[model samples]
Target chain A: MYGNSQFDGSAAFSGGGFMPSQAIPTADPSSPAKSREAQGLLPLTVKQIREVFQASDDKANFLIDGVSVNNVKLVGLLFEKTERVTDVSFVLDDGTGRIDCHRWVQESLDTKEMELLSNGTYIKVHGHLKGFQGVKQLVVYSVRRITDYNEIPNHVAECIYVHCYNTRTRKMQDAPQATGQLPNPAVNTPSKGYQPTSSNHSQFSVQPIVDGMKGIDKIVLNYIEQPSCIGKENGIHRAELAKQLNVPEHKIMEAISSLESEGLIYATVDEFHFKSTVNG
Target chain B: MDTSNPAAFVNAELLRMYVGRRVRAVIQVLRNDGGSIFGKSTDEQELVVKGHPPNPPTTFVEVIGIADSNRSIQAEIWTNFGDNFDVSSYNTICQLANGDFKHLFI
Candidate 1:
């Protein structure tokens, strides 16, 4: 291996099964071709992993929470109760559950980083999901050490957003199609301020509140429709909105702004306090 | 971390990981070439083995050897010689795409 001494750790990978390719070097099993798919990756708890085991039709293809998982990613703390193999085997726990993660080779062993990978340390695992003998395990591609504890909660929140966005979009498309009309009839029209969709027009009949609205806007309308938020008389506060959807305050403000401009939600007491037109 | 370098391709590192470890992976023997047997993974990547194991594709094979790259592996395959592969160790190969978009799951 005629190479620079700076890449000393790189040699460890080539020792057993690999011979440094004079032709072309394939870095790790993770390839560039797969990354083009931007949608559908989920961050899951151990309890949710059981769904993948039941959902996978075969070992090669699998789904988690009805979303087709090309590669399953998860964040969790290391659990050390499991048996160890040379350069393989890591059991992870994210409080909701625990699962085994295996690597084909040992990358960082007998090092401070390996020591730091002890029980209870948070790690972000990007890997392929595998099921063996009715149990699921992750055939890890790469494992990153998580420095910040907040990343754990953020990871879960992002997964919820992605899943919610996908499902809501699917539901929106389905609602229009149920009326036996062309889907997305609003394509050609510019809203002169909250135009009711032609397909939904007959369905809503007397109620304009069931008009053509985006997912988050519809959810906000529903939130105001709730007794607790509406019972406040002044309406739900801004801080409560940011907390409920688990989004930033600014994002909630944006949605609220659009809803107000569309004449859907109206301010009651202050800018943050809002009541939907239908709820009133 | 370096994406420009072809050597930094993820499959290359994967080859290094599988070396010497006995993995029960699902493999399809595309063709057997006398002393050398060539196979295909479920991910549709090429798998080359220097030694012979069994006939038929889409079956389980017990493999232990070295990985030259993610696509090219030199495995001493142990076939189940039955309709199914091994229960405990068959490698169920899958190509994963990470959210960061930086990870290349081949």
Candidate 2:
């Protein structure tokens, strides 16, 4: 049994994932799909739309009516004077609630169809409710021109959907498979003297060196400026240098450990410095 | 970049000792978990050896190959410790030229 729900519009799906069957709302018995041609023109107010459907607790399909549209924005088509197939959607704000109005124009709708529905054109849409990934929407069947300028307070003609696809099926075209063989890594070899700095190593070096160390290059320069008798004499004591640099002692210790391991620096007792030519 | 090439990591000083001699060697990478040895004909390829999480001391690696006209075999050991190890670490060792292998443990 469904309990009392707080959702204002017809109860619809609530989570996100594509479930096509649950998306489409059933048409009202009086407004049969077959009678679309005879019921060609029906004048209805926004309030009447709200009275017809009750919000459901189900997670599949729901209806949204009497919602105010908002955030009407536009995107441009590439070729000038050429109308391309596009899909548009807008946010429907109903003061108490909000939902997205999604429109899907099939690829089959050619340039001619786009010409008929130019940008900034206001049209009344007759559609059934559909839900996708728990979001309630109106899957428009047919749209007619609405001469009333007041209906569409905001008009933006923008193509929001872009896809690489086959013209007929609208399915994505397959991209060329990567050669299947690994690329020759030789070409990507690093230049000589170029040393990679690790994020952890740099973080360790910077934070412990200077208060709020902004530039890593500056810290490395500072370290280089203070020759620690790395190669010529006993290396600088890591703990002593860390204190002088005003950096976290632990970070400096870690950096010293890594540098010593990498042969870039040498350690003697508690001191660390650049490796001597003889030792290096 | 191509650490898989055995010649790239071979000590240049050791290589000069042989000059134009062809030496065959098997580079093996031993995992910390006693996993299978990663054997390769050339040191050109990179071998990724992972460390157990939670509390890992460090991961060990070695580049082994023949040098001095196959008269002598050489191995360079290195340690890497962190959350995500760099692929360059493997390549860096492979590109060491002429430098003493002991220099790595400065």
Candidate 3:
């Protein structure tokens, strides 16, 4: 339940991971071209960055959690600051692990930005990941000191969010094959219609869905499916549900009606109350 | 210093799990007495931080060191996290790093 969870938005966060990775058409002949295309900036912790492996044949590509990653970002304490004639480097630690990050001073702006960092200051680094003789380091493109402390936790949450979105969704995609269930085409047809056009990670990060329904519809359904909500005589009233979710009365009504039509939920006591059709 | 073992993020509760091991935490300074700091953990539990305070004492400080005891940390590295910080958010990070998302961290 959201009440005792570490993050109130974690339900929404995990929902993003449920989007079928197969939604992206992989059958296209342009597999190599698609793989070469730029991936969205991946938010990762230093520990996860260390776990990434370089592609066997190509030195350019990197993979984390069995998926390719690019343009990674992290927030950490700037522990060691080194300024050289050609480039400036820093050792950043975000508690999980430490990583060496460097930015080439190609112009005055680069030097100016790098000068703003000092040891013990928290900074956000946006850069590419590179492996130098089997050691991983971040090739810093942009670095900014974190003035607002909230960015620290926000970065951690984002890392976990992307981690789940990449790894969990991939597991779900591979689950049927691993279990010897060779592609249930009958059940997969309807879910294909709901796939988004863009495969960008950030686009679907907040859009949590349930049984092809989204937004308030999904939230209401999930709330009713909670262990406590099942098998109740009257179930939960629309007024109580709306009050609990802090949504307007009409929006709850809309979600209930939509969910009812989809057969995910049914009217239990009169038209105003509802419960999930799935049993306890 | 080959990183076979690394410091983990810990709050007051998790610090107990890492006794005599390396850990890191953000503490809101309650009192500073030159060599030692009396601070409150992100989870709002009191902790003694054994380290030198930064010049012009920051309200929030992150200490990376060994968890000496459940209620104390022996600081090796000190970072000034400025006067204002979102303690609740930091608390959430502590929970996630040690809880459901533990594998993502060291």
Candidate 4:
């Protein structure tokens, strides 16, 4: 019963009428046909993409192959509120020389894939095509962050290479390749002992150089409630300090540097000690 | 800038009150050689006029408390008629105030 030539990629059941095999027979008989279909679908590499387009009918589906996709949009929903997946949407670029994508849902999304979707995170998606709002798009059923060779399968690795190469070419076109040369000053002599810092510091002090500097008054007032942070013992690193105050690191550093220069605080390599009025 | 008009008088005082509360108000500076004047208040609050002018000029106007169906407090200002004014200046001053004070001036 097993060695029949008629089983050419299609399954014929024992029933008299032939049921066109909906999916490839796996070792487990209970697996859903949709899952099998998802596994069978091939992953498209980024290099193969020329453009992406939004499906007109289903705002969620995107057409990548230059053909109009009339289907539902693919969306992944997560129940757990995780930082990585919140407030993120992905656009799938099919290798067709366009940017075709769809906005699937209004509610916030959370998923494992979102963690890898951060800036500079690379990932691969495996999903089935679904039509939403008259557009055909991939609904990711499974996704994995791309890592070095050992982690990814061979086929997936090839796809990643193709994608990376295409992305590099596109980036090059956007920014001209630099020739890396020094400016020529054959006629004019280089200026000697030009101290630009004095003038620069004056202007910097007059205006708030940092984008999101919290006012010194506000900081002093708010610090009262958090008494544990009273002294230099609780001094946080520049990055951590910025995050706590919801300001940029450079701004915090600038504020500290200014206060230190003014003799208001004692500055060391890593921390600044707020001067106690009682000492005076 | 006709300070003679009662509406102009009320608006000028309201502007001072707004600024005292750190709220900004926009007023059109109209000059017909005499003085600058304003008409119409941005907010609606009752004016409690007390004491005559020029005798140390102490006037206190309380913003009448009127709660609407939505539970939002309404402020109304009262002024006598006949003052020529501009509305655009008041709108600008409201914007200059922080986002929190916009409703107060508005």
Assess every candidate by TM-score.
0.35, 0.20, 0.67, 0.20
Q: Using DockQ as the measure, which candidate wins?
A: 3
Ranking by TM-score: 3, 1, 4, 2
Q: What RMSD value applies to candidate 2? A: 30.2
- Which wins on TM-score, candidate 1 or candidate 3? 3
Tens-digit lDDT track for model 3 on B1-103?
0234577878898899999999989999999999999999988899999978776569998888989999999999887888888888888888988899988
Q: In terms of TM-score, how similar is model 4 to the real structure? A: 0.20
The C-alpha lDDT values of all candidates are 0.50, 0.32, 0.72, 0.31
Model 4 iRMS (Å) reads: 31.7
Worst 10 residues of 4 chain A by lDDT: A178-187
For the record, the alpha-carbon RMSD of candidate 4 to the native fold, in angstroms, is 26.1
Model 3, span A210-278: residue lDDT tens: 534668998898788776887587788999999999999999999998777655578886998888665
Candidate 1, residue A96: how far the Cα is off, in Å: 0.6
Q: Report the lDDT tens digits of candidate 2 across residue range A1-280.
A: 3577576443344221333343332443542321221211222222222332434555332221211111122211111122224654543321112334455666565333434654333355544444345444554444444443222211110000100001111221122210011111122321111121222122222222233233433453356334454334655565556667777777776665554443334545545543321222
Each prediction's total of clashing residue pairs, residues at least 3 apart in sequence or on different chains, is: 19, 22, 0, 38
Off by over 4 Å in 2: A1-86, A90-99, A132-135, A147-280, B1-106
**DockQ (Cα-based) for each candidate:** 0.01, 0.01, 0.44, 0.01
Query: In angstroms, how far off is B3's CA in candidate 2?
Result: 63
Write down the worst ten-residue block by lDDT for model 2 chain A: A156-165
Every prediction's TM-score for the first chain?
0.46, 0.24, 0.56, 0.25
Looking at model 3, give its docking quality level: acceptable
